[model samples]
Target chain A: MHEQDTEGVKIGLEVHCQLTSLATKLFCSSPSDYRGKPPNTNICPVCIGTPGSLPVLNRKAVTHAAMIALALNFKIPERMLFFRKNYFYPDMAKNFQITQYDRAGGVPFATDGHITLDSGKRIRIGRMQLEEDPAKLSYDGTIESSTQTFVDYNRAGITLVEIVTDPDFESPREAREFLNKLSSILEHLSVSDLNLEGSVRCDANISMAGGRRVEVKNISSFKEVERALNFEITRQRSLTSKGIKVMQETRHWDEIRRITISLRLKEEEQDYRYFPEADLVPVTLTKQFVQDVKKGMPEMPEERAKRFQKDYHLSGETAQILVREKALADFFEEAAKHSKDARQLGSWLAVDLQAYLNEYGKSLEELKLTPKHFAEMANMVSSGEVSRGAAKTAFVEMLKTGRMPRSISEEKGLKVISDTGFVESLIDKIFSENPQAVQDALKDPKAVNFLLGQIMRATKGRVDPAVANRLVRERLAAAKGSK
Target chain B: MTKKQRQEQFISEKEVEHLAELAKLELSKKEFTKLRGELNEILGYFRLIDEVDTENVSPTYHVQDIVNVLRDDTPTPQQPDMLLEDAPQKKDRFIKAPKMI
Candidate 1:
C-alpha cells in the first residue's frame, strides 16, 4: 500500500533509552530493578539528591553507552563532561538534572553517526548523550485535572542515553522503521531491554511546508511514536491548507485521546542554566579504552543476518525476519544445532512459529516451546515419522500445553501410519468397496487425488500423504496390468 | 553615576526577577533590590578573572585534576523504611506532595 503523500514533511526523533542492563543506578548503589517495588523504596541519598550527598558515576553505564556509540558508528571524544541543567520541577528533588551538553564548553558522550533504515534512507544521528532520569510522578487523575501527585524516586538517577536524530525522516513510517532498527541494535548490544514498560521513550519534532517546528513529547512506546507523528502531521497539514501558520510549541501526546495538546508556548521557553557538574569528574576515553570496547562488541544484527543466510542456507527474507528480533534468531540457532535440516528449521521458525506467536499476541520468550522441541518436530517431519499436518497439530498442542512434541503426538494419535501391511489392507478394502473409482483412477491421473483423499479420510489424516500416494499409484498400475 | 546607570552597569531588577522565577523563589520587592545589589557585588568580584589573557588556554570544566572517578555497577543494601522516616508527608509508601497542575 502506498503511504499518503507527505511532501515537505520533516520529522526528527529524540529517543531516551534506560540502560537497564546495569546493576545499580547511575550515581547511587540503589538497584536498577525498581519496576515493582514500592515508591521511593529503591532510592539512596545520591539518587534522591539529599543534602551533602555526592554522586559517583557508574563505570559500566559509560562502557555500555560507549558500546552503543560504536555500534552506531559514532565518534567518541577524548573526554566527556557532565553539566547540571537547572530547572524547577517536583520530579527532580535536586532541582537540576545531571546531563551531558554539547555546548557551553561541554562535550557529549558521542556524536556524528547515522543509522540506515530498511528503505536505505540514512538518518544522521546528531548526537548521543548520557543523562539521569527524573522521578516518576503519578496523578490522581490526568495531569491537568489532578489535585495531588505522588512521587516515586525509585526511577530517579537511573542511567539514560538520549539519541538525537537529524530531521531526515519524511514520513511517520520511516520514523517507526528507524526506531525498530535502533531497538534491534540495542538488543544485540545487550545494553537495554526494550520490552520493559517505560524503558524507552521518544519525543518527536515535526514541521511541514516551511512552518515552524512543533515538538510532540510523552510518546511512551515505539508504536506511539508513529501515531503521534501521523497525528501531528495531519494537524499541521490541516492548518497549512487553511492558510494558517503552525505555531512553534511543545505538545504532549495524549495516548488516550490520540491527539497532541499544547503543553507550553514557545514564549515560556525554559532557560536551563547549564554549568559544569562539580560533584562528578570527567570521564576520559583513551584510544586504548575505546579499542577495548570495540573489541568486546558482539555480532550486530546486519552481520547476523548475513551469517544466517550463508551458514544456514536460508532465503534472504527468512534471514531478515529471524534477525529482526534477537530472541527469534537465537532460538533458530539453538534449534539448528540439533536439526539435520537447518533450512527447514529456519522456515518453521521464521514463518510457522512466528505466525502462532502473532496469532496469540505473545513473544517468543513467553512461549513454552523450546528449541529442542522445535528441532524434534522438524526432524520428525524430515524423517517422515509424522506428516506435516500431524506435526502442525502436535505443534499447536505443544504451544498450548508446553508438552514435548513426541509426547503430544503420541497422546493425540498424530504419528504417521507407515506400516505397509496396515496400509495395504486399508487400500484393498477401499478398492473392493469402489472398483469403479479404481478403474477411473487407472484411466485418469487426476483421478488419483480422489483415491488419495479417500485414503486420507479413512486414516483420519494420520497416514503420510507421500507414502500413501506412492502406494495408491502402484496398486492402480498393478490392477491395470492384470486386466 | 546615576542610580539607573549604575543598575544598568551591573544587573537589572528585571533580570533578577527572571532569575528568581526560574529558581522558584518568591521574593518581595525589598528582597529583590537587595539581591540585585548583592549579585552585582559578587559579579564585580568575578570580573577580576577577566584580566587573564591566556587566550590559548583551554577552558577548565573541573578544578580537580581527576578523571574517571567511577564505581562498579554493584548494588548495596537499602533501607526504605528508615528513609521514609524523613518524609514530611507520606501516603502508604509514597511521598505525597501538594496538588500539582
Candidate 2:
C-alpha cells in the first residue's frame, strides 16, 4: 500500500491466542482437551453456567494473562473486572460472555513495531489487551440435526490473550506477519500450541474512509484473514463511491461466498448495557505484584532466535524455522549444543529431520529423539562413509529400528567404495567379463567413460562416482603405456 | 461498587431472568422467584469479604503448579467395527446427513 495523500486507512486487530495452560479450562477445573474427551463429557456447571453454582476463578489464567500483559508492556490495573458481554448464540451455553472490556479500567499502552507489508509498508501497533474466550460451535449447515449440531465447551474457559494493533497495516500480508510474530511469541512463552484448533483467532477490520468501518468477525485462519479483509475493503470502497452509506456494523465472513455479510449493526457500549459482574470480585494489582509476575515469564522467542543464529552459527532462515515452534527449537539446541558442526546439526533439524517428524504426525516428544540423536545423525552425513541419500534412508530406519546410525549403514551395506585396491580389483573383473566393452574403452576417445560405467554397474553404485572415474582414467593411462 | 454488585446485592427479577435466558436455562416461576434471595446471600458473601485488607492478597485465581496434563496425541479412537448398521446415514467410511441448513 503506497502511503498516499488520501484518507488514511487505520487497522487495529484484536487477536486471541488460547493459552493451552495446564490442560484445565478458565472457569472450571475440567480438562480443556477437546479431542481427548467425548463430546458433552467435559461440560460442567461453570462452563454450562449452572445457576446457584458460583465460579471459583482460575488463578493460573490470571497469572498467565499478567505474564503476557507485562511482556507486552501494559500497566496492570488496580482492579480487573469481568463483565458479562451479553449476547446469545447456540455456541455459547452462557448467553452472556464474561469478558474484560474497559473494565481493564484505563490502562494505556502504545507499542510500535515495523509491520512490513506485502506492498512493503510498515504499520504500527496501537495497544494489545488481554481477554478470555468463548466456546466454539461447528457449522454442519443444518437447521437442526439435534445430533450433528455439536458444541465442545471444553475450550469455553481457556486463558487467552488478545493483541490489538493499530490499522497501520496497509495490506493483508502485513497483518498476517504481525499475527505470525505474535503467535510465535505466545508459543515461546509456552502459553499455547500454535496448532491447537481454534487456538488463535484474527479479526481484521478494514475501511477506506469514504465508508464506515466494516468489522469482519472470527476470520478462522490467517489465509481467510487476507481474503476476507481484501474483499471487505473492496466492498466498502465500492459502496461508499456509489453514495450508499456504509453503515458501521459487525459482519461475518461467509467463507462460501468469500464475502462479508452483516451480522448486526455495530452497537455502542450503551447497547450491552455495561454492568459489573456481581458474582466475581474485582482484581487489584500493586507495583510489587507486577514485579513478582514479571519474574515468572518463559523465555521470549525473539531473543532465543538471535542466540540460535549467533551461538549455533545457523542461518537466519534456519533460526527462524527452528524458533517458530518452541519445542522443536529447544530440541535442536539441546541435541546440537555441545557438537562441533553446529551448521550441519541445524540443517538436519531444519530440513530432513523436520520432514521425518511431520510424516509421523508427531512433534519432538512423540518420537524417541534427543539433541544427541540429531547430532549423531548429522555426523554420519558429514562423514563420507555414507552418501547423503543413504544417510537419510538410514536415519528413517534408525528411528524405526532403534539401531545406531553406523550400525544401520553397515547392515544395509551403504558404505562408499573409496578404496583404490577394491576399485582396481572390480575393474579387472569388469574388463575380463566384457572384452567388447574393454576394446571400446581402449579405442574410443571417451573409452575411459565406458570403462568407468562398467566399473560402476559392476559395483552396484556403492563406489563413489567421482572416485570410480579417476581410477578408470589411471588404469587406462597405464594400459596405453604398456602398449 | 459495580452495577453488577448493586444489582446482585439488591435483587432484581428482570436481570436474573435475562441471565437465565442467556444461559438457555428454563427456570420455573418458583425457582426464578426464590433465586433473588439465594443470589443475595452469595453476592452478600463477596460484599463482606471485599472489605478484607486483601491489600496484599494477590487474588489467587490459579495456584502456581506445573503439571503436564498432556497426551501422546494420537489419532481419533477406533470406530466400532460394526457401526450400529441401523443408523440413519452411512456412506463410504462416513455417515451422511439430511440437507444441512
**The candidate that achieves the highest TM-score relative to the unseen native structure:** 1
- Top DockQ model: 1
The stretch of ten residues in a row with the least summed lDDT in candidate 2 chain B is B67-76
Question: In DockQ, how does model 2 score against the reference complex?
Answer: 0.04
- Scored against the true structure, residue A390 in model 1 reaches a CA lDDT of 72
- Candidate 2: which stretches are off by over 4 Å? A1-12, A22-53, A90-95, A103-132, A135-158, A207-213, A221-270, A337-339, A351-373, A384-483, B1-101
Whole-model Cα lDDT per candidate? 0.88, 0.65
lDDT of 2: 0.65
- DockQ by candidate, in order: 0.66, 0.04
Q: What DockQ class does candidate 2 belong to? A: incorrect
Residue A226 accuracy (lDDT) in model 2: 68
Q: lDDT (0-100) at residue A204 of candidate 2? A: 75
Q: Give the per-residue lDDT of model 1 (tens digit) for A162-195.
A: 9999999999999988887899899999999999
Worst 10 residues of 2 chain A by lDDT: A104-113
lDDT of 2 by residue, A145-256 (tens): 4455445455666556666776677666566666666666677776777676677777877776666677889777665776777677667767767889888788887778
